[model samples]
Target: MVGRFTRGLRVVDDSVDVFRDNPRLAILPLLSLLSIGGAFAIVLGTALRYGAVSSVLTSDLLQYAAIFVAIAVSSSVGTFFNAAVVHCAFQYFDGKETSVRGGLAAAWQVRRKIALWSVTAATLGTVLYIIDENFGALGSLARVLFDLAWGLLTFFVIPVLVLEDTKGLRPLLQESGTAFRETWGESITASLGISFVFFPVGVIGLSVLGWAYLFASGVPALLIGSAGFIVLVAAMVAAQVLGMVARTALYRYAVADEKVGPCAGRNPETIFPSD
Candidate 1:
């Protein structure tokens, strides 16, 4: 277990190195968040202003439609940017410099696939949301399990879509699962490694907030807490980008049988040791 943890840290380090080399990879997720958030805010504001939310909630079809819209918007934006990030990672792997514009262009080239996937994912997400919201504890448990399975199955979907010619949802999903299973052990450890590195940063941020609350007051405490919050959020964003970079690295090894950047010339076992 300790060995695996140590290796996970190495994976995290490799991912961080990728980030340092192409910091613009960070911009993809930031744009995703901003686009999704802005869309939600606008939709919610318009819905509330027009008093449409209550009516939508009262009607089953309308409720599902609303849920679908929400899921589709967020998932579409996220999937697009995720593909962009993966594209940039591949560029790095190919010994080329990466840029935000290049990533966006690569992602834009596959806009149709992105749309289809967004709809499919949103449909499933809407169904899951309904089951979780209406079926009590058992439904919630089922939803959790389904979500876990879905997450694993689609683990490499972004990279597959970005790099491979596999078309249609079924083929895309199958290829993603295939790639993930090819590197299941490494995939699990990579996540653990990333968490191991970022967990301490999160704790320090929380500790700062605690200190501010206990030993400071008023404007000083507010400022301290705000700083802590920013640190926490930054850590979260960095962790997310790190996860993307790690996933891209794993995909390259698993699918392309090529390792580049910090992952080059390293044994897979040593980089992602089994517990």
Candidate 2:
């Protein structure tokens, strides 16, 4: 387990090379964040203008529908931009020049598939949310376990949908699961390693803000807190971008069996040394 964690950490660290090569990859997630945030703002504004929230809350069916719509929209937008990120990362691996426009174009080419997959994801997510809210402690545990399993299964689905010629959502999920199973250990460990690295930085940023709040006041505290918040957000965004790059790298190495560009010169054992 220790060995696998180390290998995964290396993969996460090496992903920095891809980020440096195409710093603009970070822009994809920024676009996603803006798109989703804008969408939610519009929804909230419309709901407030029409008093839709109270009506929706009055009926369980309406409440679930509202949740479904929110999840569906957010999932669709997030998945679309994630597809773009995977597309760009694949191009980078192939040693071809890539741009944000090119990545967006690639994702556009598979818009229908992405949409279908997003709806499926949203449906399951909504069901889980309902279960979590309605059931007691057992429901919460089930939701957590199911969510973890779903995440692992769908880890490679975006890449598959964007890069492969899979026909339908079922096939997409199947392919993603197959790919994940093939590279299960290293891929999962890499994801965990990313969380391990970023979680502390976020906590430290909050800790600094807490200290400032206790020791300083007025403009100084505000400045310190503001700066810390900005830094924390930047770190979070960078972490998301690095995760996509690392996923692409791992997919290329484990699934595609091609070790080019950022993956070159590293043995497969480097990522799966225990194997």
Candidate 3:
């Protein structure tokens, strides 16, 4: 294994290069659209069946339980698939030809690790939700704290799993720590940038849909609503794909810059070392 301290510092410095060379960010939204459709279908179906739409705030025990289960499973599959796509992007950046099929295959190959990571994240989120629901005193602060901690710790989990080809809880945690310490600021910025770009698109799309719904009636309203929903789903998937592309490029840049470790004789770096 590489020196943890050195890898940490390098990751931080190289993350800028990753951001600068973020060509892959442009395509992420499209990929996200595809993935979100499948994931949200299950979620929406469960919600409708449980009457979750009528009163999400006042959902019964069974309704809440069903929603939680649906969310957890959907999130797990989405996370795994997204991570695999990121891995494929990394391979492409490294000059190894790759395809979505290859990426999906890689994702399935690491199913266990991805599932574990997804479950851990989902559990944490669920716990925070429960706490906030039951304890008004905790408020948003608790949720914020939980998210921050989780985000920082697992920022590099996907990268580590993809590049290092390592699996299991210990490796994920260790690699994530090293990657974060090395490139925390860049990682956070890249993440925020992706979110910033998507949030506006989502808001605008929903706003337009809302206005359209007011003017239309019956089937027309339903048609408009369905179209709006499709657009929203597409936008979400695109965002995810773009995010993966950016993240993959960034990680590759970091690795090539020797911020993570020795260049590993990959790509253009194999011919010339990064300064």
Candidate 4:
């Protein structure tokens, strides 16, 4: 676990440098977040129309169905945006100017793949969520373990969907899982390293923002504090974008066995150690 954590940190460090080197790439994730928010708002608003949220929450079938559908639609939108991010990241990695238009266009070109992958991801996500909502002590453990397993297997699915010459879902998923198993530590460490980097930053930012919000009793001060919240949220989005790039770097290394992101002059093999 310690070694895996170290691997994850290396990915994290490299990701930070990549984002710093290509600050413009942050625009892709920012746009993705806006798209996701808009898409989810529409989907969720439609779902809420089925019945009152209180009623939906209480009825087992209605609640589960509502939540599942909402999750699936939201996940699909997220997957779509993520594929766009992958395209932009790869383009930037290869020494090209990344464009939002081209990224979205490429994502549209492969919409079917995004939808199929979203089905798999959303199903797993909804099931794990349901497991937590419905079960007891055992269910919590199951949810955690299931999430961990799913994370490992699908970590590179978006990148594969974008970069690999594969044509079908079966091969994409199978190849991603195989690669993940062979380079498990890198994936975990990447996740761990990202969390490690973000946890404190998030806490500190939110804490400071919260204090500012508390002290701002006047309307103008309150507006300033609200803007601070927006900054905090934007920072969080940047952190997420950083993680996605880091994950993509690891995927590139795992698949191509080459220098990537922050690890650019170093030995690529060290980044994807099996043991």
Using alpha carbons, what is the TM-score of model 1? 0.88
In order of appearance, the predictions have TM-scores of 0.88, 0.89, 0.69, 0.84
Clashing pairs in 1: none
Residue pairs with backbone overlap in model 4: 8-189, 8-190
Off by over 4 Å in 4: 1-10, 42-51, 208-216, 220-224, 271-274
**By TM-score, how accurate is candidate 3?**
0.69
Better of 2 and 3 by TM-score: 2
Model 3 over residues 111-185: C-alpha lDDT tens digits?
777778767766766777777777786756888887888777876677776667676788788877776665554
Highest-TM-score candidate:
2
Which segments of candidate 1 are over 4 A away from where they belong?
199-222, 273-275
Cα TM-score of candidate 4: 0.84
- Which ten residues in a row are the worst by lDDT in model 2? 266-275
- Of candidate 1, the 10-residue stretch with the lowest lDDT total is 266-275
Summarize candidate 2's per-residue lDDT along 1-275 as a digit string, tens digits: 77766766776677777888889988888898889889999998999999898998898888888888988898898888888888888888877998999999999999999889878977998899889989989889999999999998999888888888999877888988887887776677778777877878878788777878889899999999888776676677777877887777777776778775435677755556435
Residue pairs of candidate 2 with colliding backbone atoms = none
Q: What is the model-wide C-alpha lDDT for candidate 2?
A: 0.82
Candidate 2 Cα errors over 4 Å, as ranges:
205-222, 273-275
Best-fitting candidate, scored by lDDT: 1
How are the candidates ranked when ordered by TM-score, highest leading?
2, 1, 4, 3
